[model samples]
Target: MFNDEPGDNETFLYKLERESEVQKLIAHLKRSKKTYVRRRAATMLGNIAEISDPNERRQAVKALVSAIKTDEDDSVRAAAIDALYQRGEDAFDYLVAEIAEMGGSEATERTATTLLTEWLSADHLEFRMVAATALGERGATAAVPDLVRALTDPAPRVRTRAAQACGRLSDPRVVPPLSERLSDGRQQVREAAANALGAIGTDRALAELVPVTQADEEGLRLIAVDELGQFGSVKPVVVLVDALDDDSTTVQRAAMLSLLELLTTASTEELELICGTVVDELARADIQATVPALLDIAADGTRRRYRQTAIWLLSRITGDRYRSEVIDCLLPAIDKPDEETAQLAEAVLPELRSPELEKRLRVYLSRERGSEEARSRAQAVLDEICDGSSGELVTTGVDYTYVDSPADYTNQHSSRD
Candidate 1:
């Protein structure tokens, strides 16, 4: 029934001084019959909160809180809530108090849960998002149905918050819907849904997540593979192993990491089973793509066992196929402060003995730029390879025979060597 030009209020509000403007916007926010006018006034009040005047800021905040309590239109109320949020942490307390007051002993006497549930159906997107988040935080089981419906909200953030809230609730009923969101167009939304499914952690939730690793979208497959690790069950090991061959390098890396996570908690039988599957998969995988990921895991200082596994995988996968690349990857590990890691790198170097590897090692030793300890390690490796003691290589659980001429070794020593 009310009509006004959109720019009319904005122009008039801009002409007023700061103090008068705050008061004028408050009047428009409280009395404007036009929905857009009230919405704009509420938005302007929030903007005014940034001013240096504490009294003016207080008045603007009070007006916004009043508008939220009395506004008939959901859009107006949503604008007020968003504006309060923009005012920063201090204004946020008022917003919380307003929500809490809804259930206070007044004529309406609406319970806080009932009001939040009702707001989930509000016309504005912010209202639905805040309502969904609050319901989940409160553990309002009765609001689960509404929160589930919110998972399909038109706004991606609303859907994301709803998904997160559903996760906090950890209700099995929300699992199917959360699973559906794993295919949501937005990456954040898809990730939220995957997280929610993981939080539920039911057998059914696990079942839903396992198949998503094979989803056509690499993003979905990545999320599923990552989430599968949190289950701490060996059931996803084979799927994760198979994922090592995924066409996407990122997904393949995620699969490898998930396998490592599973290894941390697997029983002896499970550990052997997983290790065997991984070894078999590595044999079939295009492991060249995984070199970077393996190098990172090996370099990580947090987990010794995983680091050992990474080094072993590198040896088995690269073999002699990627001589130069393997040398580059392992060289830095040679002087690592960790004795076991340094030893592991030194041990694997001989297994990779080839004319090309020896040449690269000699070049590394010749460089004046490398660390002294690393240079020393390289010198020893060069010595072992040239000494022909590398003839019976055994560290990597793999064997190779190298019969390079003594002449090849004689002049290969660098100035430092």
Candidate 2:
């Protein structure tokens, strides 16, 4: 009783089915040989799969699976497969088994590869899209080669989905093909390829990602910067640091996050190598803008080692600028609970040659509320800078016993003037 138009009469058919026309519709679905009629009928069965009645839904699922397995019309089989996919995982096993059975036939040679390849190339866009997703959800390593081949499909959606599937598979062998898509004309495809390379996370994939960071697109650059952090290598460090100057704030933030991760994760030796390069970057006026971020790491670093490294790096990079520009930022770390942070700050103090160092030290020594250890640490720094004056000040605080306590001399300079 339905018209020739596909899916246009579904609402009408639903009304009729509620009026006891369900059997007639099923008979029409089973007898129809015309591809469009069968396609619409199979689509209608999917509508039934959504029914709240469990028994009715099972019957619809049974019909949809039977249509996929036995239907001779290509469009009809595709429509039935799409219907099952729309039902989500409830019908996932049937789809996988059908594709696998088709893939394995020797004489027919309609193996899963052959079947998925054909579905991905199907004339209808929906078939190609669903087939790509199915391949990904199947999550088989064997699907890698076929998904790689789909990377160049004529439709951008197919290519995009294929790239996404390759990511889910995370196969290193797919890296080259996925890498080529990083420059795909479609932005979605480019993103999918970059993400796939990230998921694979192989040396080859990392190599592929380096070039992606150089891509003219900001989104791609941001993705590459983020992914490169996982490498924990010299190259990613260099690229991420350069990205700190990127015009896009998003890219800059991503670069900062990645650089921080590298800083926190890299071994002392790795930090040494990375720090040398970072210091060189800091020397250039163009790269000086990144100093605030370095200061943040130093002042509030999450790890003791990273905090020490950050302070050390800041010291070297800002040594020339300290008294004039960076000293205000460096001065506070001397009081941190982390002794290394305090010590690193102390080490950089002499280099600054600021008169303020001696003034702050005297204030710290005179304070009755300070840590003896902190005061001791402060006194040692004072001794290194003030030389002979340190012994005269020794009697002012309990932290200094290394030099003779000049009681009369201490009384003269002990209080803050």
Residue 377 local lDDT, model 1: 82
TM-score of 2: 0.62
Per-residue lDDT of candidate 1, residues 1-417 (tens digit): 335457666676655435547777888888888887888888877776356778878888898888877898777888898888788767856666556445545434437888888888887877886787777766778889999999889999789889988998998889889888987988889878887887787767877889888888787788888878765655787788788778898898888887777665667767777666666766776666566677778777887777877886677667555656777767778878787878788888877776666666656776543678778888788778777444232344343232245654554543238
RMSD of 1: 7.3
Return the top candidate by TM-score.
1
The C-alpha stretches of model 2 lying farther than 4 A from their native spots are 1-124, 130-139, 168-170, 236-238, 267-271, 285-287, 298-309, 319-353, 364-376, 385-417
